[model samples]
Target: MLYKIFAAALAAAFTLLLLPGCKDQAKPSETAEVIYHVCQRSFYDSNGDFNGDLNGLREKLDYLQDLGVTSILLLPLYESVYHHNYFASDFKKIDPEFGTTDDYLALVKDIHSRGMKLYMDMETQYVTQEHIWYKDSYNNPKSKYSNYILYDDSAQTKPSTIVFELNSLKGYDGVEHKITTVNLKNKDVLEYNYELFKYFADPNNDGNFDDGVDGFRLDHAMDTLDLKPRLTGLFKAFWSPLLTRLKQVNPKLNFVAEQADWSSLGIDYLTKANVDRVFNFRLAFAIREFDRDKIMAMADSSFSATPAGKQQVVFIENHDMPRFAQVVKKNAGKEKVGAALNILIGGVPSIYYGQEIGMVNGDKPDNVYGPTDANGIPLREAFEWYSGETGKGMSVWYKDTGPWWTDRNMKPNDGISYEEQKGNKNSLWNFYKTVIALRKNNQAIGLGQYQTLPNSNKQVVSFLRYTHQQAVMVLVNLSATAQKAEVYLSASKVPVNRLGSLMSNKSASAKDRRVTIELPGYGVEVFDVK
Candidate 1:
């Protein structure tokens, strides 16, 4: 009788789970405040291994927490043939080099225990030739997995027309350079991907919501999966269904896509592909030029173009781009200026690893097509934890591999490491920590509406962020010449007493609801309205 009762109760629970919107409705943590983007292999190494692993990351949680990061967006962690971890051999298995599955679970648990979020980079569009499905389907027409890949049928040689290219492994010799595109429309492939995504969402299956990852960063999220006319709408057809099913299992799971083109803002992804967030690439490109007008204009357009519930992930640099410090020719002041705009702008701020300490990219070969060539070796160099290149916890994955391995921009004891800048008052690392703390502690700055403030100096980009409870003003001088700007705010909007200065690199005062600030070349000031 008890067995029958248990079975009936199980059936009823399963029925309830199948109902639309019947999943547990827990509010997702606010993800927009700040996210730290980490290249896991270069972040920190544990167990005396040169490769940074899940355990290494877990060990460094205190560092991230102290840095005021609310979430971490990691590069791919799945088993891959390449070093950068994009082309996956298996979606379900954690890379052996990174550690076992248990290590990943422990990291996830630690992140949640500390009230932080974890987001993994996922690329379901392609897989390495070594993947089990690819190996089975590559030359065997009779194999059950044969239809899982896209192939050119017109080839004179059987299956020789398989889509193949070097993905981040081009420059290296003796490495497997072939990768197969997954057939997103295939039913078996879809089921495989659905299960993989579901597993990541709730690994323990206990549904306590404390063990699994919170979300994912969809790499190369394009509507046109293959750029061919026939493949153009596959994303809407494929991704939407997969995402819908994933949401049914875990309603709080979120996804951010790296839209194919940086020049265009991806409003289409929000409406068509059903993604939660897209990177603001146009704004990222504009900020590098240090043009106040262009930056503010792009900022306004991005925020305006976004739908009511959607968000834009804003950053000045990432793994696939040149470092912000290098783009500005290692100008500390201009770097700080860029940092100010990144954190103060009204969107989710993502800080690439080593960006807080002003780490710059090393010299690159001339005319390289991508940021760090096909291998992405230089752009994804080891993180500088200390002034000395050789030290405990240092990730020397690409050390002495080639000229790209040299630390050209950062020198030993140059005041750029955590050891060097942790306590320094005016260090770039401190600046980043303070600004992040300011954004987190102040609701007006992190989760409020943004409006550009009027300023006479075109080089000065001033803006106000406010909510019903509070308001704050941000003024940044994007030029090398010292700038004086009279910032005007409505008395009704920001009362006189509440207009006192909060933080500034330069001196400033407020009177009659107006704040006048004099910024030395590339200076920044942030004011709290009460």
Candidate 2:
């Protein structure tokens, strides 16, 4: 939660960023969050079927805990023919290949034992042909599920798809998936979604949440059902009521919505829709562009836009879009700079699977029109567990299925695997490990107020994360050249006695409270100030 964001502490500025209903509560040092967004199908395989399973993920809890990841945002695990698992064939059943209900419960229990959260991905806006609702109502208007599934004709034979009435989509696995949109306007469908989500929150009908997920990620969450609304204002009419019922089951269960429009700021989802979080898509794109001015401007606005109790989920890569490593052509320096910002920047941060090890994507798609051009296949490849790219838990489910496998993301002896980088102190994996530790160890970075300090070098992104007692200064050179930056500190707030580098032994010089810092090409450095 982005509980209390303080205003910038510059020489000419001082203000409190208090929002509604937050005047009486006492504020503590805020928590630092490192949310690891993982794709279970590619993470690890325990059953030796070339498909990753719940048992494989459970076995890796130690790895996640050691990296200081406070939460896990898992992609959908429902039994769908598509590899991404978006259009679920069954909402209630865990894919047989993934595991049984017992396996899921055990994983949730283990996550809670380590004080980590597990958020389930729930995309119910559309369903595959095999879903019970679609099966019962596709051609029979008199069926009980008639109002549950959207139809384009009064006959109910023409099932409506989401957005432009698209009845089907070709997935990355080279299959055309016929899908049907849900009639969210129906009272029965609304009740069903709430019940299904609540079941995951407290399975076995027990009040204890140990065997349940901590939250739900609402995929492609919309207010008016793709703007071709049979009912308008679903935020208040549909989503608000649905969420209210779930909160009764678990008041603290977090809800994150993926705004349907990627370009939106998604403030309405927080204020009107009653959700707890929204993806900071604007900032993610700006960071990829890497323009110094754009990053600073967008970062400030995106971090400050949310209301008091809501948070913006900041991230560089997810299951969608190209990986940060692939975007920069595997530049080591740029990779470090991008990874640091993802963790240390304001708001709750998320890292996709294999991102800590700097996983790169495969060849770009030559066409988007056919199953032959399955672009997302490369992005969802197997996790590199060994230097040879072959191991006990290697999940290459699509290895021999397509042409994309010829130039897949992982290569033998590329040094991007966890096996080789686990011991190398300078590797990207350890760099992420060290950065996460730094955030956890310091309250200022995790919970304190944020300020974008002005500096002489335009290429350097300068900022301060400070509490009343201490401050942490972060400097990153966005360009490919080394930069020396000068920033004047505000002397009126607190007396400065010491300034030291947190990531290295390099010294900083100060005179009259002005500081001079040196940053290498695409370098990121943090300093502890007292």
Best-matching candidate per lDDT: 2
What's the residue-level lDDT of 314 in candidate 2? 83
lDDT of 2: 0.79
The regions of model 2 sitting more than 4 angstroms off are: 1-30, 171-174, 366-373, 490-497, 507-513
What residue runs in model 1 are displaced by over 4 Å at the alpha carbon? 1-32, 154-174, 366-375, 406-410, 488-498, 504-515
Each model's lDDT: 0.75, 0.79
lDDT (10s digit) by residue, model 1, range 298-358: 8878877777667888899988777898889878898888888889887789999999988
Instruction: Give per-model TM-scores.
Output: 0.88, 0.92
Question: Cα deviation in Å at residue 439, candidate 1?
Answer: 0.4
Model 1: lDDT equals: 0.75
* lDDT (Cα, 0-100) at 205 in candidate 2: 77
